[model samples]
Target: MAAWLLAPQFTRSCHRQTPLTACKSNLKNIGTALEMYSTDWSGHYPPNLNLLTPNYLKTLPECLNAERVTYRIATGLNAPLNHGRFQDYYLVECTGTSHQDVNIPADYPKYTGIMGLIEQ
Candidate 1:
């Protein structure tokens, strides 16, 4: 009886976390694609995320949250200042409010050339 009662709660918790997990995974994959694209392009990152498709990435990744928005590349004035040239440093972020339930690590830098998923 107790096991049955807890099953629903456990399932609900897992369901809530699915989107968050997917969002992180998507960001990581996109970051890898970005790195690969930069390497092939002689150290210059693409001007937009769409340029990564069918080459660096099989296809563009989308946010798994309720809004289901596409992840955006943070460049130009939006890119972090300490990361050197704007073309060398870019950040990818989900533009949805659904993933704010979880907190990111304090030490995690916004742009590391590998993965940068800002949840906001």
Candidate 2:
């Protein structure tokens, strides 16, 4: 007969591993949410950071990165150049890629993000 045992260290390792794995998971979700918003004809991008939640992340064990969202915005800072040129929109992940405090909007309850006009 073979017996299987998990060492105490393994337990600790699992605890440690969970967050990192979770963080990655959260990041992926953030990316996915942005993708969804991009396709949807919302007439704009996802709402501001203050409006995000798990509802956005279909992938369980949420992990979001809030700090990154603002900086990403700069990527699309320049938009709406011409007189009749419709401004471009952007999908951002401001939070820390974790579901820490993703605002839960009744409508798009998951992804908390910002939308801005930018140039192609």
Candidate 3:
């Protein structure tokens, strides 16, 4: 009888977990695609995530439940022509969970600038 009573609670918790798991998977794939893109482009990272599509990635992965996942590359005209060699690159995913958002590569190099996302 107690197991039956707990079943519904368990199911609800599982349902809530699904999107979070999928979001993490998407981040991993995006990271792989970025690595490939860097290799092909003389170690330069894509200016935007869309640049990876149909070449490095078949199609960009959508955020599971949040608005969208964001890609931020810290490179510029005078920036060194290499990803991770001299600059900081990051991916941010807004979550459906109460945690708000999570940044891929949780660790970052010292003195990295905060790249803000414009509210849409």
Candidate 4:
């Protein structure tokens, strides 16, 4: 082995870390929103983020820092859990960030914004 510094760019960790950090931050915020939502209605998550917006959050927290925000509402989704009612729930998640190193990508951008089953 020659010298570690004398290599032709072994790897670039910065690129990977930046996005992952941002993704993690978004996840934490989303989780907090989910928790607050549960507290408001007793074990029930908001049907969607917008429901929390203007309430749990004054305005959307800007999940992704990309063009067009890359964040949008993926509508017509199946209820996240067994509410035992006629399609009475919904969900929204963050996107446009990556966490490949830990295999926990934020959601959306990579998954094409399809979190769960959705119907009109």
Candidate 3: tens digits of C-alpha lDDT, residues 4-120 = 111112123445655445544555556666667766777667677677766765566555544454333345433323334535454433333422444333222111122223121
lDDT score of residue 79 within candidate 1: 76
| Candidates sorted by lDDT, best first | 1, 3, 4, 2
Instruction: Give the residue spans of candidate 2 off by over 4 A.
Output: 1-17, 49-55, 58-75, 78-120
Cα TM-score of candidate 2:
0.33
TM-score of each: 0.64, 0.33, 0.50, 0.44
Number of the top TM-score candidate: 1
- Deviation of model 4 at 63, angstroms: 3.5
lDDT of 2 at 107: 17
* Residue pairs that clash (backbone atoms under 3 angstroms), model 3: none
Per-residue accuracy of model 2 over 4-97 as CA lDDT, tens digit each? 2212132234355443344433434455555454455344444442222334432223222332332222113342222333344443332332
Residue-level lDDT of model 4, residues 1-120, one tens digit each, is: 111111111122345435434533444445555556666675566545566565665445453344223333322334333344333233444453433344554453221122332211
Clashing pairs in 1: none
Q: Rank the candidates by TM-score, best first.
A: 1, 3, 4, 2
Write down the worst ten-residue block by lDDT for model 3: 1-10
Q: Kindly report which residue stretches of model 4 are placed more than 4 angstroms away from their true locations once superposed.
A: 1-17, 68-93, 96-120
